[model samples]
Target chain A: MGISGAAFIAGAYEHPLRVIPDKSVAQVHAEVAAGALADAGLSFSDVDGYFCAGDAPGMGGIGMADYMGLKLKHTDSTETGGSSYLVHVGHAMEAIHAGKIKVALVTLAGLPRQASANLQMGVTDTPEGGFENVFGPTIHGMYALAAKRHMHEYGTTSEQLAWIRVAASTHAQYNPNAMFQNVVTVEDVINSPMVSDPLHRLDCCVISDGGGAVVIVSPDVAKGLERHSIKVLGHGEAPKHSDNGKIDLTYTGAAWSGPAAFDEAKLTPKDIQYASIYDSFTITVLEQIEDLGFCEKGKGGEFVADGGLISPTGRLPFNTDGGGLTNNHPVNRGGMTKILEAVRQLRGEAHPAVQVPNCELALAHGTGGSIGTRMGSATLVLGRD
Target chain B: MTEATAPVMPAPAPIVNPENKPFWDATVEGRLVLPKCQNCGSINWYPRVFCPECGKFGVDWIDAAGTGTIYTFAITRRGMGAYGKAGPYVLAYVELDEGPRIMTNIVDCDVDSINIGDKVRVVFHDTGSGSALPRFTPVS
Candidate 1:
């Protein structure tokens, strides 16, 4: 019972708005769900399984299901921060394979920009919170720690990490819906305000308010759809934590999840023509590109240097939708958008300027939570067969 | 080396729980203690009841030398939430002599001069609660 060919991502939709001040989070969820189902040539009535993450309002999947009028036989509200949607895709594939349901709808939405004033460090009365919250570890600070360590150990320079943002911005030029459509240079990133050591403001993803959805279906239901569906080739997820004070900031959970995904897909990193590497920050992409076996562990700097990740001319084209970097990081969760871009690439519907030619096999990887502390990482392999 | 006075930081009182009360109790007395698994003889940080290594329920508190080298650090120019105004601080992990690293702040020194492998010793910042948060300063 593998995910390979077990399910198809028949529908994918991304909200055109990067800022949705007027709409409620629940409304965005419903809108994306409808867009995805409509893309699949189906309607909300066809969805029998609903999947969501912490981004969902109220009781998670239960609340969204009721709001959307989704009569479901099965539902999942697994929350993994940013990577929740990728996890949902995997869970949906398993459910479909088990014959639990024929069609599953996964939705994600957030308005962090609108909620920015109220954003807190998220310290609370949890098990690890008492110990960690006192020190004041912001999201930027967490990734900055990893970046600093990676540089100290591997001689990774801030310039090398800058290439990732450059690549994202380069592709973003053609994405009309992207928040930042202007192409930037390495010098630009290096000169940007330092929010945290080794991480400039441009190195981080844009905060926006929007949502996206993907409709996954069993092979039987997929064959009846009017649009071509991307095959679910493989899936993997893993959690990386501080190992009881023996924390290693040099790597991420991608080291475990990426291999598990590639092995299940019976493919190698070299086989992937396009990738949707989550871009919470520039260092985020560099580390995942290394851990995903695209390059050696400490060789990420060289791997991404000199247009390595730029589309068409680059070695590995990634985040053609501008990713969370230049595009939008809705709700501060990027997993859903990662899957949407991969689906677009496999279907050859990505922006022509950044779309990989003859693109057949693509991989999308997402990291939820902080890479500096604990994180939930998920990887997926999708193909057009 | 000790700071002439306690460095000013937004040291919030840790939410005390049953599992970590002993560790905080030691801090209030101006000491750093770690949980040592009696079954495996492995020392763990954060004072967990069970050993993460051997999965043993029995453990003992061991006083630490409270001196370690910096593992990694980042200077946050803009902090988070309540820490939003507390910028230009060094957030670091200090690898203690007890074979475990603890997340802490490296204070009372130039933030720009802090680096990995710099030796540091522990100092306490009273959180207005009974317990004090253990931080580190560069070994001059």
Candidate 2:
């Protein structure tokens, strides 16, 4: 049978993850968790299984285990690419299946803003300790490579790429925490000094220091918890590469994850009222839209054009929090923000500036891994019912 | 894969991810390669030892056409770390004629004149490691 779950009380910490200066990853988690518990009207005692998706190796589940003094009934410190927290839901569900506990906590944080983040050149971790670093392939360069490939194949325009930045910037206007709220046009995106070939500084995701957390309680326990509960509904995942590139860059494995999730949730692209997609980059969302069965594969660029995904007139709005591009990307906490916004919309608490009315259903998807190959994607659907 | 240059860096040692040994070998020798899964007939990337689509282990390496088009690109005005000297370079995504798009750098032409869908062919840019890095050049 397909995976099924009950009511969940979730929390989202949207503070400028880069806001705090000198906060350790652990401090970020503790602060985010405390804020999350307060928002959920619950205390640390209510949490049983601890999960931390923070990028730093030491601060995942073990970090939380040390912090809250959790007995560690069932803990998952899954450090998959960026969509890791979404993957946490999958692990948490398995723990529940194993009868480990009734409540679970997931958190993410980093120091991109404080300049404490190790952003000397490329990716956060270089192929596990400089293995790939010496290759001269930084994360931005890899992504820059992918972006150029996407453009060449589909005849996608830099203007088209700018469309994503424009959409995000427009969305950021309402989100005070968003760093670049000032309106930036397509010309601005194109003119921005290039960081790598085909990738401008604006095209790349900024490294910032920030943290966010979410709590998941069983249906039975969730009923007594504060705030309107959102059921897990369904979760699914797939990978094109685990440690190395394994498949064609165009066709993706995320499509496999999306269909299973939609089938499990009994929902479709049209069924969703809004979507909070992971936005590490504009192209990441473009490819996921293709892979997630939202639109035909190559047609993604066209589908998103002409105010489609970027246009407010489009049916399904995305990345309600300005996404990783404009918002804080504290080690893929960008993905966590997607879930956080989904929870708020389900509870009818979205920012008044960009809230979708009667937002009963939503989609949150992520691609975690290097830009070129060996990607991981997770699809999740949330419903108010 | 090769010697360290101003932009491209050399591997401190050889890469050994299991599936991509051949790709690295070819890189050290200055050739671009990809993988075709035996079970699912899928062409995949990053040189995996197993098939990602069918979960089958019967996969082998194959060389690409070395011909493709520019999909998108960024002309770097700034560089970081060891690459700090490479302020104005074109990091490109090239769509191979065989249907897969690869992340690579574009060379041998003015970065401004390059646009999406422009024809490109593979060329070797020495990494100074002893082998040259595979880069794409606009086909005249």
| Model 1 clashing residue pairs (backbone) | A110-A331
The TM-scores of all predictions, comma-separated, are 0.97, 0.81
Off by over 4 Å in 1: A117-120, B1-7
DockQ of 2: 0.31
Q: What is the DockQ of candidate 1?
A: 0.69
- Cα lDDT tens digits for candidate 1, A1-385: 3557799999999999987889888999999999999999999999999999988998868998889898999999998889999999999999999999999999998777676544345667777787777888888888898999999999999999999999999999999999999999999999999988879999999888998999999999998888999998999999999898889988888999998888889999999999999899999999999999999899999989999999978989999989999997888889999999999999989988888998999999999999888899999999997
Write model 2 residue lDDT over B21-135, tens digit each, in one string. Answer: 5665676666777778888888875456576578888776787878997766666455456555654666655678877655566776766678778999987655544444567
Q: For residues B1-140, write the lDDT of model 1, one tens digit per residue.
A: 22221246788898888888999999989999988999999998767889889987988988999899999898888777657677577888889988888888888987767789999999998888878989999999
Candidate 1 local lDDT, residue B39 = 96
State, as a TM-score between 0 and 1, how close model 1 is to the true structure.
0.97
Please tell me which predicted candidate would have the highest TM-score against the true structure.
1
Each model's lDDT:
0.89, 0.68
Chain B TM-score for candidate 2: 0.81
What lDDT tens digits, residue by residue, belong to model 2 across residues A1-385?
5666653645555555456666676777778878887777777877888886546447457756776666667778776667788888766766766667777888877665555443334434333322234434566666666666666677766677677777777777887787667767878988987666566667666566676777777777767766777877878888765233323455555778788788878878878877777777676777777778778777777776655654235645777677778876776446677788788778887777677778888878777776564567787887785
Query: Which candidate gets the maximum DockQ versus the true structure?
Result: 1
